[model samples]
Target chain A: MKHLVLGGVRSGKSQFAERWIAEQRKQIVYIATSQVWDGSMAERIAKHQSYRPDHWHTIEEPITLADTLKKVASEQPESGVIVECCSLWLTNLLCAENEAQLTQEREQFLAVLENYPLPVILVSAEVGLGIMPINALARRYGDEIGVLNQRMAQICDQVTLVTAGLPMTLKATQGK
Target chain B: MKHLVLGGVRSGKSQFAERWIAEQRKQIVYIATSQVWDGSMAERIAKHQSYRPDHWHTIEEPITLADTLKKVASEQPESGVIVECCSLWLTNLLCAENEAQLTQEREQFLAVLENYPLPVILVSAEVGLGIMPINALARRYGDEIGVLNQRMAQICDQVTLVTAGLPMTLKATQGK
Candidate 1:
């Protein structure tokens, strides 16, 4: 089973995804894609860590997410892999890689996602709803994230959107 | 009937709101809260204008949304009013006012919304779903928009979130 969860900041998407994964009764492998670059982000990361159970395994990988996911899947094929978000991963790539590298990395990530054996639950931000970004970088970020989401939605078995602490399934079970 | 339409950029929120209002058979008054400050913004404004029907009344009021809505309501009591968005209005307020004035304006807007006589469809971006802004202004904008969306949802008879052009009702008319 594959699930893609999307929501805005503080909309309870992470909590909801955590709860859903917990219900799966499989070993949980949380792949956190956040790199704390500032004090506020460190706090946010700490807050997220506190919410997660101590028993669950966590992998903090800021880059090379697809490679990390592949390793995890190969080691624990039965376990459920939860990628906390795609936005941060994209951000890291945006800062670290050139355009060609980003395109290659994105493609690699998508391939890994398609071939992964475990039940994968991915969480990402729905970023395009706000006002047009004033600067070039923010605008580019928005466009990339939007496109990434659309691509993920196409491959995932279930796609759910969380808003104001409410979840609505956009796509369910492929056929049902 | 009051509806709160929430969506990310290009989620077709405005189109959904416009279609809903068109079905009402009442006079349609679009209160757009964007001021074209640059070429990109001007293009956006023009695109929005093109989507709107020629017969529908349009008001391009960047600030003073509550006052404009009130005046329109009194003059065209039978018309359905569509506020293009709340974020831009908030942007205008943030740019033009001190904290005290913003509070006063927000309060006044809420009061007016509460007593609004005609059917109203309010559109706003669900901006809180993404990353935490690094700067004070962006962070402040996120907090204000999230709070604003919550407040509006409470007053609205229907709250719908649009994702990839799909509209899902988060809250609907009670018992109806």
Candidate 2:
């Protein structure tokens, strides 16, 4: 039941993914990776927070993603798990200001994906379709995230893209 | 040669679509639908503006979408377009508050899309992949946008999804 949901900003991708989780008949752990470093983001994050059911356990991991997922979802067999998003985690990884640390963190994150248990669902942004970033760092970030996404898509059992609020499964799955 | 690029917020989706446009050897029109109603949006809009060549014709149409596209894309064979995004337009349509008007407007948009010449690439968010929305309007807006996206995907020559800064073209040809 591993799933990948990808879309652009305000494209209704998040609401679609959340609805999917609400319908699932398993205990759930909602993993959110947002760090409120600004005012608007704080507001937006708050809006998102108010939408979840109180009973659904949530773990906020600004970093340390692999370890967090392993710790939270390792024991839940029947319940599904969600990594709310990947783009922020990638941002956090890229902006660590330590190049070696960034590489090590990314590799560790990728390594954790290999055998993580639970029917994991990941929400991530599809950011490479727009423009060629004019800066060196933005381009590098894009490339690295692109690689990470491809690996996720290859490993995940399903890949879903929502546009204009519609959900269309790219890597089709038969899960109810 | 029509194309649509879909991705998540800050997902580098806009940049990806912009890069695709920058590579085009044809005359270009940049249709920006974003309204800089606040400071954050203004900053983002400014960042995007800095990326373009000085000669590319620009059209700022927050409404009247079909008429604008038809007007700008009518003349040349080698003309291509980039719609910076559809989310704002979706919001525009929602705020119109007239179901009949929204229907008429969207129909006009589809009509304009029907016979437009050249490669027009639309950039939109892949929203609706998250939890169920809290309000009726939000839920309805999500559904409406989803319908619009599927219709556009059906008509366009190519549909690509970007996630974590990577893109995979799901539908690459018209009527496929």
Q: Is the docking of candidate 1 incorrect, acceptable, medium or high quality?
A: incorrect
Model 2, range B82-117, lDDT digits (tens) per residue?
887876787787887887878888899888887767
Pairs that clash in candidate 1: A8-B128, A8-B129, A9-B128, A9-B129, A9-B130, A128-B9, A129-B8, A129-B9
TM-score winner: 1
RMSD of 2: 11.0
Query: Model 1, range A1-176, lDDT digits (tens) per residue?
Result: 78899988767788889999888756899999999899978988998999998988999998788899899988987688899888889999998858888898899999988866788889998977666557778888998999999999998899998776568889998421
What digit string (tens of lDDT, one per residue) describes model 1 on residues B31-135?
999987899999998998898889999988887887898899889998988999888899988988588878988998999998788888999987786545668
Candidate 2 chain A: minimum summed lDDT over ten consecutive residues — where? A126-135
- lDDT by residue (A1-176, candidate 2, tens digit) is 67788777887777887878667745778889888889999999989889887788888987788888777655666677888789888887777777887777767877877676676788887666544334767767766676677778766767888889998776755644
Candidate 2 local lDDT, residue A73:
59
Model 1 reproduces what portion of true contacts?
A: 0.28
The second chain of candidate 2 has a TM-score of 0.91
Best by lDDT: 1
